[model samples]
Target: MPTRRYDNSPGLGSLYARTVKATLRKAEYEPDTDGLTLELPRALVDQDHLTAYREVTGFSAGPALPVTYPHILAFPLHLDLMSDPSFPYKPMGIVHLANTITQLRPIPMHAELSIKVHSGPERPHPKGTVFDILSDVSVDGEVVWNDTTTLLSRSPGTPSAHADLLPDPCLEARAFWDLRANLGRRYAAASGDRNPIHLFKLSAQAFGFPRQIAHGMWAKAAALASIQRARALPDAFTVRVDFRKPLLLPSRVQFAHTITDAATDFAIYNDDTTITHLIGQLVAR
Candidate 1:
């Protein structure tokens, strides 16, 4: 398929403005297309941005780029595709239900890289409609990293009888993180994912949230960070996460993991409650 190429990155403010209008207009659902492909210019990693990301997520500053960094680079394009008028659903309240990242190999710092993003067709889900956004990163024509992010748009519909039942909690927390109120802003600053709902209370209220919420990806990264601190991760592996609920800003959360020869099962829960915020596993590749 012919790809759209952008010389300059899309502006976040304009994209958010467009999303607001799109939400209020209540655009009708359109049939999903083959999906948009976006190719970004080759660029070197910015040291400052890398530093901030490392500090916030606790990823080590090293020769290899953190596995999740490419998602940050492709984020603007993801927003562009979702905010387009032809998109079937409003950008607001779209839930990031799951994400799976496959690190083919370690990506070196300062390497000039190319990124391509594909927003896939929407599929039926128990609660609503779901879709995949796939991203691929390459260096010198060789694909180095990729990710598949699944999102959901809730609508009036019958629940799927085939939905997988939730797994029973299997482990207790090994660590806890007391996330600060500015977590959303701090993450947004480093990741370039300044989604309004994550930035501040007013912006979140506009989107029907009581207060600001932490980014799902940030929470995932934080979980991985904690896991890495406990044990070294396999170089080639898959980290998958299902975001059950939003982690309210400035809240304390618990993390636990059950490790096996092939994979590790992990979960994040509300510090004072039994509610699961996210559940995921890391599988050896």
Candidate 2:
């Protein structure tokens, strides 16, 4: 694959404006053998934003970043690829279906890193189509972190079930979060995932959501932070989550987890635990 390098992160505003044009001039995606790669040769973490991210996502104040935080750095790359002229769907319409992240080593808050994001293979989904976006963070060519994100572009087809991720009825440790209406806006500033649907009620309603929703990555980080509060998470670990549904802002939700000697199983749900929002598992490597 050919890589497009950047000295700095691309501006989200311009990318979003491009997304709008792509949506207006969209065409059906035809699978191709070629793949795109976007790279940042030098990336720096801003402490203030990192601290703010920790506050919004329930991570502790520390030098090492939460396992899910690095995804923010790849947000523009993901958006750029999906909004490119060749992509078929409206960038805003595609849904984040799942994520799998692996930490090879701990990342310090001040380390300069190289981030690369590539378009992975496209496969058939029962509903429509599904694809993977692979990413890696490296310090001088040594990889410290990586992830695979699955996205879904919905169309008319048979609905399928995630049988392996079915919620466990006996999740014991539980907590309820009273999310505020401005939670989306707050997280957007902290995480740089300014998806309009997650930033305002009207913008969300325009996209068919009844209200603004929380970012899936934020939800995952919050869950992991909660899990860490109960038990320590290893420096080398793998955490994977399937986002079941949109979590409307200002909504109260239940979070619970089951811890064992080897791994942790966790989830987020509606206040009464009837509608599941996310299902995840973390294993220390």
Candidate 3:
């Protein structure tokens, strides 16, 4: 990918200064390649949590959440930095233009895990700024999964109602319905997120699943659909979701939406009713 360069526009100059000051004061500032360790809670894999994970990641009849769930741990770090009083922007105001997850291993169920997060400097774009975050999720001191997430914060000169508002509840939405296998294939084709655990029985079983699973984004898309259908709105708005847990395959995952004046909240649950996944807020453009 090409490196994003600073625009040097008046607005960008102002936003950059504010971002630098806020980031400098409390930034994780940990050196690149230096690892910070965090003890992962057993509660994160508790039976109840597992059930929710299975439902949300579409692993009900299959394996545990794809190795991707741990990637979400880094999101809190972004929240911490964005929420700092000195920070120039509110995360809710930013648009999640794109997200990609690359998995390294199969995260075992019922295992204690550790995580370390590293974030790079702001990479500027013509319309916004992009930052890169890398996280390593380990178990018993051995690296089990490494993930990267990118977030884009649009320039204030860009029109947005959420500029200063804090994140609020998200509206609910459903996913487009298709054959299960077709849904899996479509997402893989579009996302280049071809995890075998979501493709074939033998492939999934090799990864500790009883059956094939669904991509995490599919559930997110479903949630977005549910919200759009309920409100009868167009599909051009912005969305930002935190993948709290996974949803399993071949199960009915119920989606609920709650919209406040400022934002929308969407949650997905398994048939057992555990919160398999949660989307913090979806902003209407």
Candidate 4:
């Protein structure tokens, strides 16, 4: 796959900013979900680009697509909504904080689908501000998958962008699972995120990490699975999350999470651990 043409520098235009703010809480903008189903298209499941799709997330030996690929269907629609000219949002400056999803059943490769997107208000941040989005995908009137993502838009501040930096330790510790041969292939086919940084040891080492790192979505999937199993909610509708740090490859580390209320949750490393990578929550639908 080609390098993603991600040039989000300089931010979005003022028109886009104002437009995005205006539609802060658009109610149920439903899309046609007539043939919606958790099925992957033959083109997606049989993609020739990612050789690594056979192993890590397990795409070849099943009747389902890995959990990560739903974003392919959902995100394009998200982009469509954001660029509606009537809708509001500038994708350039927003930081993706976290992604949470629930799977009603395995997504079968080569099925038709549809989606619905919900937008919400800006969440007050400790330093900056954040926004939330909800998207639900269904098949034949039965809901199949859903995701809630948080994007943060920060305002310029603190020392006026020219102050001396304080010595802040890397607050999070993270470890990556080695997936170069097996896991990498599986994740690539499943997620459509075939960035080479996640493919091999040498490829990752060039980027300054020790070895090939796991896909952020893989860890995300694991986190969601953890929450679902613990809460025993096979059909959770929403989730809250914070990405603190990136996890490196070929390793094992501790995982911990705590919930204080309906809308608040924290996930991080154990008190004595240093390799923490992510923090977030699982919310009810």
**180-251 per-residue lDDT for model 3 (tens digits):** 544565555443345567677687778676877676656665565456457643222445555555445555
Each candidate's lDDT (Cα)? Answer: 0.83, 0.84, 0.50, 0.50
Compared with the true structure, the alpha-carbon lDDT of candidate 3 equals 0.50
TM-score of candidate 4 against the unseen true structure: 0.51
Regions of model 4 farther than 4 Å from truth: 1-54, 58-68, 82-89, 104-111, 157-176, 179-190, 193-215, 222-240, 248-272, 280-285
Tens digits of per-residue lDDT, candidate 1, 1-285, equal 547888766778888788778877755656455655788868678888898999999997678888888888888878887787667787887888889999888888889888888778767777888878898989999988899989888876447634432364588888888989899999999988888889898988888889999999998898888788888888889888888888888789888998889788999999965889999888888
Cα lDDT for residue 278, model 2?
Answer: 91
TM-score of each: 0.92, 0.93, 0.42, 0.51
Best model per lDDT:
2
Better of 1 and 4 by TM-score: 1
TM-score order, best first, reads 2, 1, 4, 3
Error of 3 at 173 (Å): 20
lDDT of 2 by residue, 179-284 (tens): 9999999999987788889989999998899999999998999999998898878999999999998999989999989888787889888988888889898888
Indicate which candidate wins on TM-score: 2
TM-score of 3: 0.42
Question: Per-residue lDDT for 7 in model 3?
Answer: 21
